[model samples]
Target: MPVDSLPNSILAHMLAINNVPPPPLRSLPRLRLSKTINYGQLNALCHIRGLKSDQHSSLRLEAHDAFIKQYPQIYLHEKTVLPKVPHLADKRKSAVRLAEKKHQPAMPHNISAYLREARGGPSIDEEEITEEKFQEFLNILKKLPVYRTKHEHNMVWKILKNIPALTSQLSKEDLKILSKKVMSETWIKASTVTGDDGLYVLLTGQARRRIKVFRSLIEENDSIITSLYRDSFLFDAELKDSTVAQLYVPSKKLTVKKWGVFGSLKGGHEMNESDRSVVTDYDCEILKIPAKEYEKLELEKVKHENAKKLKLIRKCPFYETWPTLSIWELVSISKFKTFPPGHVLVESGTVISFVGYISSGYCNIYRNIVGLVDLPINKVKKMKKRVYMGKLKEKESFGEVSILLQAPFTCTIITGREVEMAVIEDKDIQGKCMNVI
Candidate 1:
């Protein structure tokens, strides 16, 4: 029977009788034989096809002899068998093409457009940014301290130019807000300096309604001579010694209790008590108004209160040593609290958790005295002997040493009269006010 007409099982049995090799049996593309056929049956199929088997291996011997004759060195050193199938050269060519394609330089569309513009090619039109938006951007740039230098300003411009969204279709106010946000996120170290030019302009303006005069006592033989202007005042009538043509700057050590209407004429100089002037013989109430209050009045009437608070702060010995920024921070965190006469502000041996500044009225300090027997009938009877340490008047601060040292109060502070004090708690200082300066 023809092989095509026979069953696969019968075909396999017939091939086994011919001694064909199993490998050659599989190489027959047209034949579909049983997968379960034994190796002996596959070997028989090669014999039946007139292909070489183990029993007749003369074909392999002939190929080996031909290879030895063609390449003697390879045949002498290494025993090798020639492959039945040839390798496709086209596969190597395809692989080389694939590798070249992967390594080829290809620019993205956006980058190409940028390059084209740089080369002065037909430029792509960017989305139009409004003039208002640009102005707002400039304002933010002006506010930043780092942008004061030309190089930093250019760097900022370059960055903004690269960001298409920042330049395209954002509103003026929105752009300003977004730019500030981006600046804060990117340059965390950058700080903005608050402008006080408006405050200065308001103080120097020619509006009499804006200025207020205050009277202060200048004691006899006092070395300090306070004046609105070092050389000359705009309101000369306000000064007690108006005849003096050559006005002198207040001594750096002079402690100015009240600022003249024009403030200190000499800028950037601090006045203290140790600073003496040429004329201090007259004992009269000097007329003056705080410049800080005058400046604040231009912004808001409520801010005028900050001037009094600032004055009080300037008088305190502890606050005098602090920087201006630190003083501002302290003032912001402190709140005013009032106590009636005979009220004990802090008891001896209690935890010192806060500091207080005497804004108004007086307070007395009493130390705990030992060796004095006391009755426990009432709260006042427990302390039979109390030694008065000192008195704290307006503009004085107490409890700072205890609070700063993180210790208990060494003495009891009692209100001698109805007093108002600015209290700054330790929690508030550490939590919100610390490191601000």
Candidate 2:
């Protein structure tokens, strides 16, 4: 047999052994398959392996499931095991639970039980006992009659002072343990507990080191406290402004009587009313305009001054005593003005006569080409319009640099379109700085 016909011959022999019937030549020609898969051989292999048809099918299914689980996408799989999904913490419920745990009230444990057990318990005075046992002793002392009497005499007494030479020997954690004992013992009977200051005083009895650290912490929170007070004051003032505004309207009489609630004073300017004890009356005429209008103008002025000061602070580097721009200086020289489109406020290489701050418009700052003025008509028409290189927008500053430096402007500053600006002369800024120098 030819090399290729050997497999067909083997297949014929295998088919003969298996007693498979031969088909017509036409049908036999169409039955081409892999020469390795002879039915008789396959049956013999299956018999030798002791594999059932159903078992083979089940093995194939398991192989596919294993492949999918192991490879996942076969494109991107996690290189490392991911952390197991965690139950999300419920913040609101957790906070409520924590607060309840904190404020649960310090009910004294059974003192009778403690006393009966204490008679047989190990003595706390043993020098060989650990620092942990000393802490326990301090906790027990807080409940004893002797310590309770000592605390009432001075509720804010220091704990470390009671332990001879403790300050030199104990660690910060030990001190914290002592503070906790103090907190629990005093908190139950605390009268006139106010703020962190009171807490510090009660903790350490105003120890110099403790008080210094506490003051630093309190001062560090100054900005946060200031922000809160500012918002609260503004809210109250806004309410008063609204009431005053409504009352002073054309058809109504403006009236508000001064009142007091303990130390709290109301009506008139708080400052003026503090010096006198009369029911101050606010009149529409006294304000020189409608109360609402006057208050609105005052608020705007105050806001403007604050913004200008903030800008100055941001622009200038911090010195030992860096100063903000004075409102009086701004008021004396700068005035808000609008420029029409194509208005030339300053020319290139010319001294900046008046520096302008963009209040409500866009302006371009660009380098001037030396030979652009000599361009031919055709070339000029073909040339691109000069690119606007830099833009100044609302609240953005420009034009002060050259004037302050007393030098010619290095670039041409042109209005992109209609613009509003607050103009100030170079001399005005110098005058303001002179006072500081």
Candidate 3:
């Protein structure tokens, strides 16, 4: 029979009636304790075993009583007489020695052994993660602490790249740099305000806007608490495009909070200390980038490109009569691209991708003309071949007529040397217009 099933009276009766094998050692839970990580887990495990969430035996007598109850058999020694002692007189005297048995429960001498047993002994089992849990496991990989700084940056960059709100505005290279400058953190206790004048992403767990509450209301469970989720982007969550970055799939059991950013944008994305504070409902993992630093970083990317593109866009004679506002719009659409010598910019009878303005070098125009084949081994035969035409020089534009009329280019154009051009592509980028012209 299991020791836990034994009744106090029956166990006593059995011990009194029969001889049994040596008493076995067992563990029982002790008092509840204020935790410390792995120590806390052990304490919680004790509580699950009907122990008081601690490993400590507060009173010596309590463990003694528990030990005796669990033990299958216990023994008491019989009293005995001692050997006779020599007397100073003629007679020797017999002495009696009293037998006394004191019971004491055995404790662990090796701390490591005791802890191992407590943690569940060495038949180490590894559980398999099922298909249903793959996503949750993937979320675990996103944790920054698991990887080194550079690796973590790359992981974050991958996530940022997928987010349409950032992708639509910033280049992949810009987002990569942004990922490196950001910081990630975790909070398990309710304390400080969230969104420290920065943008944030809650990677895991739940949290809520901590508002004021009375003790009575809390005790009665009548006070309402606003809950939050693993929102991929907060703090400027609503971008200039008016789209909120989303991550967590909404559970039918929970509703999303109507609040946009966790804090006010005016406060540089910081929660107002007087009335607003975001606290973890349990444990939370978050990534953040300071607002001021983010702006500075973005400006560096903008200024580097803007300085060059501004000059190139001004070279367009079509914009000579256009306003500065319209010129900047052109700058927004323009992308600086370079091509190696012999690279084809356009082909006759094919759609042109971009309206290009030559910034450096030139392009050789060609026409498909029916002419004799030029091969030494073969007799001359009439075939369609590329016939060299004139060249398009620096500051010259192409694809304007084709794009305006929505038709294919009339001639083929190939780069003469390593050529650079400021171009506006004629394509649909998720329905966003690329060329203002």
The candidate scoring highest on TM-score is 3
Q: Candidate 3, residues 366-386: lDDT per residue as tens digits?
A: 998887776687668889888
Off by over 4 Å in 1: 1-301, 372-384
For model 2, how does the per-residue alpha-carbon lDDT over 10-56 read when each residue is reduced to its tens digit? 44543443356655445544334342344554434323321222434
The model with the greatest lDDT is 3
Compute each candidate's TM-score over C-alphas.
0.29, 0.26, 0.35
The residue-by-residue lDDT of candidate 1 on 1-437, one tens digit each, is 24464444444553553464333555434654333435554344334432233535776455434433332121123347886675578788888999999998895568855753453222423344355654454454444544445554444354344433233333443333233222321111111111121111110111111122233434433232334333232321244563323323323332222111112322212432122111121221222122343343334533555666677787897677777777777777777788899998888998767788898999999998865444577423334467999999988888766765668888898999999888889888767764652
lDDT-better candidate, 1 vs 2: 1
In order, candidate lDDTs are 0.49, 0.42, 0.54
The lDDT, on a scale of 0 to 1, for candidate 2 is 0.42
Which segments of model 2 are wrong by more than 4 Å?
Answer: 1-322, 325-333, 372-388, 434-437
| Shift of residue 358 alpha carbon in model 2, Å | 2.7
Superposition TM-score, candidate 1 onto the true structure: 0.29
Write the candidate numbers in order of decreasing TM-score.
3, 1, 2
Clashing pairs counted in every model:
16, 0, 0
